[model samples]
Target: MATSESGSDQTSSALSDSFRTPYYCEENVYFLCKKLSASGTAAADGSDLFVVFISNEKKQTPLWNQKASKRADGVVLWDYHAICVQRKKEGDTPLLVWDLDSSLPYPSPLTSYVSETFQPSFQLFSEYQRFYRIVHAPIFLRYFASDRRHMKDSAGNWTAEPPKYEPIVAEDGAVHNLNEYNEIHAADVMTNAGDFLNAVFTQRLGAVINENQLEEFFLKMP
Candidate 1:
């Protein structure tokens, strides 16, 4: 991994150039997962690619080390954010997190990413607490669709420029279903750890987990 500051900056810049847009984190992560799947770095079937959605009931998620923040601390309150996590079957390799908007290393180790980005040790109001929804990348890539409607103002002005590329459509031809992935509720969180893990890998919407459970849940993945 790129441990030096300069090396990390270069790697992050290159990844941003390849897969990032101004405000389309979901699409950025979608393409990232697609590339990882095609690279055959995960299982041959790409079963190890996971997409993580971060937000809370109030849509206020405070993440540190984001490129979008002007604060000296690099903390940003995003309505929602998306990132890709890849788990290698090899026991010696740590899981990796690919976040286009993060100022962290291009592919930070899952533990480091969770610690620095989520800052679980930092206390916050209930509304500012973060929740996560983890989806199997293969299933997400097949069913995730977006038309960029979420970026518009009430009068239909673009909040930010849409990606130069065409909007993403699901394999089944569905479009504009972005809310299904972004809207995570605490009620949806699974109480049983086994059920949560199973749903995360097998269910369409996957499972919702709280910030405290994020690291543990992903670490438990095989």
Candidate 2:
């Protein structure tokens, strides 16, 4: 088990060191879910693991306390970001978020991760407002494929080096289906909270919810 010190600046180095990768949050999270599921920290079938993608129609979501930021406030404007959320079914463990890019503690409690990272109290322009796509880890793992094409410029040069490992391909042999998971539309926002909760676990792409509903959405998860 990865142990964390209360109020530590970051999660135990061991966990982060094992999973951290630069500019590949989605892939980093894919393997993190695998670790949690295989290690038995999550449910044996991995139902306890969820992938929460944060972004907006503009792909201009601003998040704070990200390790990638050089600013004193540790803020970074991301096109999209991904994190692993663990909601164990066993004894009352708080919902935990594993963000490899965050300066916040590794596997931070969902509440703290939301309050500090999302800063819902802080107002933002409509274009900068954040949206979340919550996908079950099992479904995400099986279907999430990324060719890393988005990282390239029009010139086809590598904007950032990709992982040395081969790109992820879905079990069904789909390549470059990343947009299916990263893209969120304003029209798709679930108006009924009850319907959103139920759809999140059942749908392959999961459900899209706005920033205000983020913490509450996960808190209400089974």
Candidate 3:
């Protein structure tokens, strides 16, 4: 499969109209996002008893270059996006993830030869536009762990470096997605997590969020 740079779906639509119907997105591509997001509610179903779409965008076509995006077969494909979904709720967090299935394997663009030479790398919460939107509230962005370095002064045992991803009462405390992830342990820590996130948001994001919407978003999170 030939992958594009930006991976937008605009090119794909043009292909369908110019060509025939019943075309397919490259491997691991989908268009389910329009089911709920087109209206803007972004309502998702968590009770289906499978991988949850923690993060995702409509499936898109890869961009071949700056001005134009075409397919490896020269079909001019379009419509592409990343998605982060998982079976475990704890896995949802500030980190970036793959679309649909966590193991969907990115960089795996539709190629003309259909050979797996280059693979894409992406996570759910961190990186690109996902990071920007996750920090904003009115939506639940579950963060597992992001940091690993912790200090255990006079105390004993392995303590979670950053805390706040947990479900206990919180005040300026939450989790954040880590772009540089080596192990899952870093984002799994709690306690100081929520408070830490509050600080980051206030200091960096300013006041683009409404506390009520943020709280309500989390409240509905499972």
Q: Give the better candidate number (1 or 3) by TM-score.
A: 1
Residue-level lDDT of model 3, residues 29-104, one tens digit each, is 2222222223222235421111111111322233222112243422222332223222223322312222322122
Give all candidates' CA lDDT scores. Answer: 0.82, 0.82, 0.25
Q: What's each prediction's clash count?
A: 0, 1, 57
- The TM-score, computed over Cα atoms with residue i paired to residue i, of candidate 3 is 0.19
C-alpha TM-scores of all predictions: 0.91, 0.91, 0.19
Candidate 3 Cα deviation (angstroms), residue 199? 11
Across 153-181, the per-residue lDDT of candidate 1 in tens digits comes to 99999999998899998898998888988
Clashing pairs in 1: none
Question: What are the C-alpha RMSDs, in order, of all predicted structures?
Answer: 2.8, 2.8, 18.8
Residue 167's lDDT within candidate 3 is: 26
List runs of model 3 lying over 4 Å from the truth.
1-82, 87-132, 135-222
The predicted structure with the larger lDDT, 1 or 3, is 1
